[model samples]
Target: MEVKKKLLDIVRDTVRFKHYSLSTERTYIHWIKHYIFFHNKKHPKEMGKEEIEEYLTSLAIKNKVASSTQNQAFSALLFLYKEVLGVDMSEWNIQALRAQERKRIPVVLTKDEVKLVIENLKGIYNLITMLMYGCGLRMNEVINLRVKDIDLGFDKVYVWDSKSLKDRVIPLPLKLKQRIAVQLEAVSELHAKDIKDGFGAVYLPYALEKKYKNAQFETKWQYLFPAANISTDPRTKIKRRHHILANTLGRNIKVAAQKANLNKRVTSHIFRHSYATHLLQAGIDLRSIQELLGHKSVETTMIYTHVISEMNKAKLISPLDF
Candidate 1:
């Protein structure tokens, strides 16, 4: 089989398994292509554990890629071998690459700095940032939020299909309820316009479009942060509503940070870090904070303990001992 034909067949088989996102599909294909090129156009079937080890070592030693990048390549190759090519790699003993110990702390903002950043943002961007800090939401989660996912009556935001395909409910800050209400009103107007223009389709996950058919067009399924105009779906080539672009929010965040005179580097995820740290400072239990941030493990939530310890060290002690 020709290499190009085999690559296409492998991609099709992977997609047929379902549940994979377009981003994952694209990444997997790109890495697989790179792997083939690295071996001087040798077919992956002709290569074995030795070739795989060398490719991974090249990624670490020569290319100097991060551990995560190498891991992504490993996963892609594993899928190609085990699933696409129907080969068992379980008995394979490939040499492992040593990953460096990264000790970089996440960038966090002080309470005043968080307030300053939000205050500098105007309109929709302001509301989005407030939710990021208030609910500790990831940038993608905030952008992918749908109308029905928010339960203002219960004061919780349903994070559906999150990072790990897990769903969790996080508290909606009472302080931002009114702001959310105003944003919802704007969303309602946009929803009405989309319906009138016959472009109300929402972007469904993997195979849901085939299952529900018109569920994408339902108002309840509309994006909370809808794009200003209709655009063609890159996969289906159908005109539909998509969420706000990440770059748009990214640019606004940079401008807002500058206007607030915050010298520290700030990004949308900084609000999430500040949210977790602020809760820790307020004496919230680690377990409770874990649930609020929708972290799967308490270990993931433990990073905030370091921030709290640093803050406590700065406190002035009295000269007189008890």
Candidate 2:
């Protein structure tokens, strides 16, 4: 079989199985293409374990790709052989040189610094950052938030299909509830316009679109932070509203951070780090914080313990102590 045809078939099979996101499919295909091209367009099936090993070694020794990038390539190839090609890759061994692990702590903005950053941001950008710190949400989580996910009356925000496909709820600040209510009204108006323009479909995950054909058109299914303009869906080619772009938010965050004169290197994740540290300072349990952050492991949450310990170490001792 031609390599391109075989590759397309593999991607189709992966998509049919609904294993992961469309983004994953595109990335896997791109890496596989590069692998094939690197070997002068030789068919992957004609290559064996020795060829795979050489390719991975070249990534480390010649290409000098980072450990994570090499790992992603490994995963993509593994999926191709095992899931797509119907061959087990368990017996194959190809190791890239592992990168050194760094112990650098996450940059955390002080509460006052956070306040300054928020104050510098205007309009919707300010609201988004407030939610990031207030709820300890990742930037993607904030962007993907839907009207149905927020429980204003209960003062909670539900995060669904988070990293690792897990769902968790975090407390919503009461002060933000009124602001969110106002935002929802604006969302409703925008939704109405989309409906009027005959573009009332929502983006659903895989086969869910078929199962719930009209679900996307509903108010509850609307994105809480819809993009400023309606755009055609790349996959379905249907006109629909998607969430705000990460780059747009990222640029706004950089400007806000600079205006605040914060010395720390601040980004969206910094708000999340600050949120966890603040919670630790306020005596929140590690496990509880882990749940709120949707962390799969308790060890991931333990990073904040060092922040609390350092704060404790800074206490002033009595001058006349015996």
RMSD of each: 3.2, 3.4
Instruction: Give model 2's TM-score versus the native structure.
Output: 0.89
lDDT of 2 by residue, 1-322 (tens): 6445667565656865764766787878888888888899988878867777778778878888777777778778887777777877777766545444456667788899999999999999999999999999999999889989999888999999898678998999887999999999999999998899888677866577778888888989888899998898766587888989888998999999999887778889999999999998888899999999999999988989987777777685777873
Estimate, for each residue in 153-237, the C-alpha lDDT of model 1 and write its tens digit: 9998999878866788988889988878777878888878888987777888777878999788777788888888889977669
Check candidate 2 and list the clashing pairs. Answer: none
Worst 10 residues of 1 by lDDT: 96-105
Instruction: Evaluate all candidate structures by whole-model CA lDDT and list the values in order.
Output: 0.85, 0.84
Which residue pairs collide, candidate 1? Answer: 202-216
- The best candidate in terms of lDDT: 1
| Model 2 lDDT on a 0 to 1 scale | 0.84
